[model samples]
Target chain A: GAGVSQSPRYKVAKRGQDVALRCDPISGHVSLFWYQQALGQGPEFLTYFQNEAQLDKSGLPSDRFFAERPEGSVSTLKIQRTQQEDSAVYLCASTVGLQETQYFGPGTRLLVL
Target chain B: EDKVVQSPLSLVVHEGDTVTLNCSYEVTNFRSLLWYKQEKKAPTFLFMLTSSGIEKKSGRLSSILDKKELFSILNITATQTGDSAIYLCAVERRTSGTYKYIFGTGTRLKVLA
Candidate 1:
């Protein structure tokens, strides 16, 4: 793909349900990132990966939020026991390296009811 | 704590009006500053500034970073309704052989046509 791709542009989950959001980064990009954005706010850092290596997860709000990129290509973010506060847009971005311009995806909008 | 903040959290400007969005940051080791424009979906890359005092321009948009002042400003001339969106500013840091990026709260621009 010419740009980053995210699946299920919109998702709705119950309070106790778990959901997974997928992201396919740009081809040959070595770095990928995840971010969470609330209504009327900017995207907040969630995690980072450098070719399948989870370099940083400090931005994850809690242990319930898990992200994995085992293949260095596609990645998934899973949220457990969804809460209303968790309703936000999840964005995925890819860059050529640690210090490069990152291309963004359309993002997945999650609504927890 | 590392942080970035945008001023004029929200603004409404008539078409053809020029506006300036401000962003200030405090990072341990700032590598670069980036700006993005958020539409109904994802945020698209606008500009990246690493060296201070060098202005980057694309169409009617331009941005400049001041390392000494730890701030960046984006200028949009002759705005249109299509220019209405959330403007995000992020700061990148290089640490522990890895790269980290953080985002500010963002400034919402509403251009009235």
Candidate 2:
């Protein structure tokens, strides 16, 4: 893909169900980022990965929220025991070279009901 | 914690009108300020400002950074209906080994036809 690509444009999950959001960054991009955007709010940093290594996960709200990029090219964000507060648009972005310009993917909108 | 604040939560303007959006930040070891335009899903990259007094322009959108004031402004001239979107501002900082990015609430702009 020319830009970052995320799977499942929209998701509806029930309480306590686990949901996994996938992201395929641009080819050869070294940096990948995940953000969570709530309704009427800006996107909040969830985690960052530099070539398959999770350098920072401090932004993850709780232990239930986990992310992995085992192969460096693709990533996944998983939320365990879904809660209403976890509903939001999960966005993925990738930057080429250093952390310079980021290209965003059409986010996966998750709604927990 | 890093903080990014955007002013004028929402704005409406007629076509051809000019508008200015403001963003202020407070972060430790601030490395750069970035501006993005989010319409429905992804937030497209707009500009990245690192040094003071450097203005970035593309078409009718122009942005400038003021490191001394810890603020930045995005200006749009001759606005069109297509310009309606949520404009987000973010600040990137160096914390730990990787960079930390924090975003503001964003300003929603509606350009009337």
After superposition on all C-alphas, the RMSD of every candidate to the true structure, in Å, is 1.0, 0.9
lDDT of 1 at B46: 98
- The true-versus-predicted C-alpha distance at residue A23 of model 2, in Å, is 0.3
Give the 10-residue window scoring lowest on summed lDDT in candidate 2 chain A: A94-103
How would you encode candidate 2's per-residue C-alpha lDDT over A1-113 as one tens digit per residue?
58899999999999999999999999999999999999999999999999999999988999999999999999999999999999999999998856588889999999999
For residues A1-113, write the lDDT of model 1, one tens digit per residue: 47899988999999989999999999999999999999888899999999999999999999899999999999999999999999999999999986899999999999999
Candidate 2 chain B has its poorest 10 consecutive residues by lDDT at B92-101
Best candidate per DockQ, number?
2
Tens digit of per-residue lDDT, candidate 2, span B1-113: 57999999999999999999999998998999999999999999999999899899999999999999999999999999999999999998887779867999999999999
Q: State residue B12's C-alpha deviation in candidate 1, in Å.
A: 1.0
Looking at model 1, the pairs that clash are: none
